[model samples]
Target: MTTVPPFQRALEAHGDAVWRYLRGMVGAGAADDCFQETFLAALRAYPRLHRESNLRAWLLTIAHRKAIDHLRRRRRDALEPLGEEIEAKPQGDGAIWSAVATLPPRQRAAVLLRYGGDLAHREIAAAIGCSEEAARRSLHEGLKRLRETL
Candidate 1:
């Protein structure tokens, strides 16, 4: 049987990536709460998980759902810039992220999982809960929109 890492170890290893994904998904404003909710949900389900493979993808899947739920609660189809009061971002990144925030939900999640989370297309598909072809399409559509907007 495959050995699963302790839950804390998985958290330590993947926390930053998950947080960044959440930040990119829901924006910095709600990332912390989303992050907490993601991990809490993951922790609850971890013991039932059968394999250690693709733990990052599994965590990201939870994060994606949490982000979607958060967005739904706010009653928005697209994310919006939280303005200058938000946390510091790298130079010239604001415009791109602003454009990213305007993408449709699946497109945005696919883009963030691929680029922001640095996950492969297969993993992104798993995270976004779609077929690989769908994830690729979403990524393609999202990048196309960003290019057109920026």
Candidate 2:
């Protein structure tokens, strides 16, 4: 049977990638909270996992879900009548990432997983819960859109 590595090892190995992915998905404002939620949920589920295969992808899947949740909450919060909040725009690489944030959810995720997380198409398929072909298409469409946007 395949053995699972210690959770700490997985955290050490993948934390940055997951954080970057979250930042790409939800913006820096919400990325930290989403990152924490991802790892917290992963910590809860890690023991139930039977094998250690693709821990990075697994963590990314959790991160993706957390990002989605944060985005939804942000959308909901935006609809409420709260005082105007001015968030500082990110600079440098953030400019490209801001364009990335404009893509549809699946496409954004596909781009982030491929470029930011450095995950293979198959790993991205697993992370985003789609077929490999679908993942590839999403990545393609996202990149194509980005090319036009930039």
Give the TM-score of each candidate: 0.84, 0.87
In candidate 1, position 147 carries an lDDT of: 93
Residue-level lDDT of model 1, residues 1-150, one tens digit each, is 575778999999899889878877777778899999999999999888877468888888899999989989766645544433133555457777667777888998998888777899989888777899999999999999989998
All candidates: CA RMSD (Å): 3.1, 3.3
Clashing pairs in 2: none
lDDT of 2 by residue, 9-105 (tens): 9899999999889877887766788888999999999988878468888889889888877778778877521111112453676557767877898
Cα displacement (Å) at residue 80, model 1: 7.5
Worst 10 residues of 2 by lDDT: 79-88
Off by over 4 Å in 2: 1-3, 79-87
- For candidate 2, the per-residue lDDT at 49 reads 82
Q: Residue 81 of candidate 1: its Cα lDDT?
A: 48
**Model 1 worst lDDT run, 10 consecutive residues:** 78-87
Report every candidate's CA lDDT.
0.83, 0.83
